[model samples]
Target: MTKNCFLKESKSFFTLIAVFFSCCLFAQQDDLQSETENEFWRNVQFGGGIGLGFGSGYTDISLAPSAIYNFNKYVAFGVGAQYKYLKQKDYYASHLYGGSLIGLLNPINQIQLSAELEQLRVNVNLDGSNSNSQDYWNTGLFIGAGYRSGNATIGARYNVLNDKNNIYGSAFMPFFRMYF
Candidate 1:
């Protein structure tokens, strides 16, 4: 009977150890899952920026607001809109309204490369003419690089567009963006 008692005691002790270890492992897994969820939601971000460019016969200033949703650490997609005002050397000022699609190479950490395509409506007033009511559509392609830390991003882009007069040129824009 002594042998039977000893065997029962050893089995109970092993069972208790197994349950304790299993509970610890489960708790660790739960903590890891919660952390991962937090990081995923943190990848969703929003930002805005302003920039200027100077070219022959015109100087341009623009504002853009953007938002992004990151499904993971390495990929993100976003949409944004921009408003641009252009002042020509001897012509009436023009206004442009546009939107873009933004893609990122790496979204959750520091460095990223981006590409964007945008379409705009350009409205211009003819000099000294009552026919200040001309409107046209333009399309732009922009390629850029960026870096992000905390809530701020700084980037530069090369933008090309076809205007109403079939004028095509490249503009450089420096921007600051914030994420919330």
Candidate 2:
């Protein structure tokens, strides 16, 4: 074949291959998008909170971490772990560890409602001359409402099942929830 003809054929061949691969890539884009849209892990979020307080011979520390799966625009379900350490000078020391299951609902863009069931194993050691340790479990069922912003909510929840064994002196707890 003539040199010019050979070059022309090669260019045509390369151009055709390029176009074929380009079309293949573009076609796969839709399939990838569709698959990821329904991916379970992709729709899951991680969030939680940490707290610390100190006052004259008194100390409090807490950590709670959680994960949730977004069912849709308005609903999510999650699990969480909690740890708390409290010490009061010449008073007592306590350790609280637990887990929780949480359900969340968003009826509007700015409102979030939640239900949480938590069970904590509490161990306390009384300070001073006659000191002793007590251990037990505390269970709480909380219902709460909050003002919601993107990926976060601030609210308070009230425990409906508060009894003598409950460690938190009150049945009300303030919360800040977030997800990433």
Query: Could you tell me how far off, in angstroms, the CA of residue 141 lies in candidate 2 after the best superposition?
Result: 0.4
Which RMSD values do the candidates have, in order?
8.0, 4.4
The residue pairs found clashing in candidate 2 are: none
lDDT of each: 0.79, 0.93
What would the TM-scores of all predictions be? 0.59, 0.78
Candidate 1: C-alpha RMSD after superposition: 8.0
Top candidate by lDDT:
2
Candidate 2 residue 180 C-alpha distance from true site, Å: 1.0
Tens-place lDDT per residue, model 1, 77-139, is 899998988888877788888898988766447977778888888888766775665898877
Prediction 1 global C-alpha lDDT: 0.79
- Clash number for every model? 0, 0
Candidate 2's residue-wise lDDT over 67-144, tens digit each?
A: 999899899999999999999998899999999999999999899999999999998989864447888898999999
Instruction: Indicate the TM-score of model 2.
Output: 0.78
